[model samples]
Target: MSEEKYTLETVLSVKRWAANLFSFTMTRPSAFRFTAGQFARIGIQVEGELIVRAYSIVSSPFDETLEFFSIVVPEGAFTSQLQYLKPGDQIYLEKIPYGFLTLARYQEPAPHDLWLLATGTGLAPFISMLQDFETWQKYRHIVLAYSVRTQQELAYVDRINEIQNIFGENGAEFCFLPIITRDPFAKLNHRLPKLIESGDLEQEADLKFNVESSHVMLCGNPQMVEDTKEALKCRGLIMNRRGVGNIAVENYW
Candidate 1:
């Protein structure tokens, strides 16, 4: 591993979605540059040592400020210190950005539909992609499927709505599907893979995904990514490798 260039930044805002989920914004340095879907190593001092974790970038590159979404594990060493952050508090960031989940990774023939699947804070990168101009220009239709234990765990609804409206403004087709596995409010109450395997996802999108013209991006839980990848494979979607295939995944593990 390369030595990290730790940059000091200040927290600007914090929004808590649930007991375990939260998001925060920070001061972006003028020299910092990254793609919308990339992640950065963020840290805070605990005791006398530095503890760090990689968080997907929630703010688009075009935005002047920096943002990150995180899940607070009750006993996590990093989150223990991170959860206490306040506005004006200091946070450290690695100068270099990293991640495979980005628009730049999916090259060549534009997909007819771009499916962004996320669970929990996994929605962070997709939010960044949606906020950027390139994503809107790359696909004719965008389907965002965000799954959580309950609808209450769905963070950044207002920001999501704003992006959907922006897509609407451009006369583009955008579908935001919220799947709550623990909620019985809707009949389609299965996990993302099951929903796709059973065709509920296609029903919701009103568009079918063909091998040649459909791109899928997965993030969030590792198991969800693997299982969903298998489900998507049944539909002929291949995982991206060395610049091939139609699926891009963020393996945060």
Candidate 2:
């Protein structure tokens, strides 16, 4: 792999999501630019060694600062160091942005219900998409199907209302369906595949799961993406070849 060109950025804030999860905002260089769904390699220098990992941008490009959600693996190579950062601290941020999960990859001539399925920290890009104007203009009905192992791990809880308001008149078409697997008291307590296969996802979104009428985006866990892809494929959905169908995936794990 090519070495990433790194730059210094000051941490603006850091907040915990759960015991093992946290989010931090950092100063964005005026020259740094990216699509809503792109990612950047960020790390810190210790004893002259530059350690970093790629993370999806959670903040909207329109925002003044950049944000990221991360899970702290106590013994992880990069994350173990990442968890030590605090406000006013500086970290290495790669100058260039990269990823293929942006809305521009959708190859259809007409619009369809944009389905954003995420688990754990995979909800980053979809949150960025909701903040951008292009996603609102492209799909009339936007369903965010977020599944987390626990309810507390669900980041950006307050943003759901703001996202709907961003849709303006079509705000009614925007839906946020949060699924928690271990929470029995929660309304939905199944994984994405079980939910999609059993038709529960469609029932909650109040929309049909048709290949022609919907485009799906998957992110976060690799196994979840794989299982969900099989479920979607059984429903006639396939990965868009040269921008043909509507399924796109990004495996963060």
Candidate 3:
């Protein structure tokens, strides 16, 4: 990892979604630039040591401010302190952005459908991608499936709905699916791998997951990323490599 000098950014706003989930915005440095799906290393000083962690940017690249979504980990060195962030708090932001989970990664056999499957805070990067006009223009359809343990943990519901409305008028069709494993009343109540294996996910989206037309991006829990990758492979999808193939993944935890 690069130990480049970090930039100090002031927190512009913070909104709590649940007891453990929140999203915050910070001042964006003039020189900092990143694609929608990239992540930045953020630091917070605790005791005397600076603790840094990678978080996906939730704001669009065109946005003046940077935003990130996080879940508070009990006794966690980084998020435990991050949960208390106020509007004026100072946070350390690395200069460079990193990650390959962008739309540019898909090449050659161009994908007609885009699938963004995420769990918990993994939904952050997809939010950024959805806000980008290029993403709407690139594909014929886009499906975003965000899974959480319960309804309360589902963050950015309003913003996501707004994005859907804004992009729905454009060329591509946008579908947002919220999967709540612990909520029986929720529309979808199963894990992602199971949903993929059983074809329930495609059924809900009214789309099929095939190697040719679909480019699936998986993020969030490590186990979910691994298992979901395998499930897609079983359906004949391959990992995105050398700017080719159908699936892309990022392990958020």
Clashes of 1: 0
- The digit string of per-residue lDDT tens for model 1 on 156-216 reads 8898999888755674588888888998986557898998899999998898877788888
Ranking by TM-score: 3, 1, 2
Error of 1 at 104 (Å): 1.4
lDDT winner, 1 or 3: 3
Scored by Cα lDDT, where does model 1 land?
Answer: 0.86
Q: Report the lDDT of model 3 for residue 4.
A: 65
Better of 2 and 3 by lDDT: 3
In model 1, residue pairs whose N, Cα or C atoms come closer than 3 Å (at least 3 residues apart or on different chains), thus clashing, are none
Which predicted model would earn the best TM-score? 3
Clashing pairs in 2: none
- Candidate 2 per-residue lDDT, tens place, 1-253, comes to 2344777889999999888899999999988999999998888876678787889999998999999999989898888788877999998888999998988887773467889999999999888888887788778788998999888888788886777775545542788899999999989989999999999999998998787777899998999999999999999888976777878999986
Assess candidate 2 and give its lDDT: 0.87
For candidate 3, which ten residues in a row score worst on lDDT? 1-10
Determine which window of 10 residues in candidate 2 has minimal summed lDDT.
163-172
By TM-score, the better pick of 1 and 2 is: 1
